[model samples]
Target chain A: MILEPHQIELIGYAAAFLTTFAFVPQAIVSWRTRDLSGVSLGMYSLFTFGVGLWLIYGLIIEKWPLILANAITFALALSILVLKLRYPRK
Target chain B: MILEPHQIELIGYAAAFLTTFAFVPQAIVSWRTRDLSGVSLGMYSLFTFGVGLWLIYGLIIEKWPLILANAITFALALSILVLKLRYPRK
Candidate 1:
């Protein structure tokens, strides 16, 4: 089925805005607790790498929606990844 | 610049693998903490919604990369969103 242009644009906007701050809640909690005990550093490390790949895919596709969502998510994922590495389980 | 089909496939694989488990680390942490205190439900709520929109976008575009990434992400996001709501902070 075909989608209207506006509908597609709306998805793009939603994709951009939503994924941007997706990591905030976790970042804040991880920051506040300063505890990485329960947090999976290994998983996040790989996960962040995975996001990196997605960002590249987005770039390759040149789809604004994909690019925008991954770009924001990549940053957030990277930040959280740093924190996870910096502070391992106590 | 134009991209080869192989390059694009590589990206699709990467996107799928990366985002699929990207949420695992965070999910495990939240599960362990059971503390929604530091986590932001508002942000996650919107964030999940955002991912949902992206999934729609992905489906609409029929870009395997977009569809794969968002579908996995949507599931993870939804899981986290549920946890955030069910287990609100003290």
Candidate 2:
């Protein structure tokens, strides 16, 4: 199936939006409850670092979807990572 | 700054590998502990769905990096989500 450039970009944006904002609930939950038992420090640590790299990669490639998504997702993931560190399991 | 196509793709793959595998620790932790206290259902629900969309988008766009990364990430995320549902916070 052939797709116009704009259509393809639109799809990319949609995908980016969903994936990026998906972390919001996680961040909010962690922040409010301060429960880090189920939250994996290793996962968030690596995920945040990876998202940062994705942001850089996006900048290098000049892809707005990649750049915007990773930028926001990085912040959210970092916040969760911080929470995990702050309130480790007792 | 000019980057060769291969170089650009290399960065994408690296980013993909990180973001995709970042879920490994989370899955393992959740699997072993079966604790969903800190794992938000809303987040996983949305994230798994989003990753599924990413997989579809990658297939449509024929982007191998997206396809490979999202496929693995989706599996990992879905597993976590299932674990979350199966073992809700006590």
The local distance difference test score of each candidate is 0.73, 0.88
- Residue-level lDDT tens digits of model 2 in A9-90: 7776777778899999999999999988989999998899888888988999788877888889999999999888889973
- Here the TM-score of candidate 2's chain B is 0.86
The sequence of per-residue lDDT tens digits that candidate 1 reaches over residues A1-90 is 677999898777867776677677767777777755555665678777877787778777677766776677778777767776887654
TM-score of chain B of each: 0.75, 0.86
Q: lDDT, candidate 1, residue A14? A: 64
Query: What DockQ does each prediction reach against the true complex?
Result: 0.51, 0.71
Residue B89, candidate 2: how far off, in angstroms? 1.0
- Model 1 root-mean-square deviation: 3.8
lDDT of 2 at B13: 74
Error of 2 at B74 (Å): 0.8
Docking outcome class, model 2: medium
The pairs that clash in candidate 2 are: none
Model 1 stretches astray by more than 4 angstroms: A1-3, A32-38, A59-69, B1-4, B32-39, B59-69
Output the TM-score of candidate 2: 0.90
Error of 1 at B48 (Å): 1.2
List the candidate 2 regions with Cα displacement exceeding 4 Å. A1-9, B1-8
CA RMSD, predictions in order: 3.8, 2.3
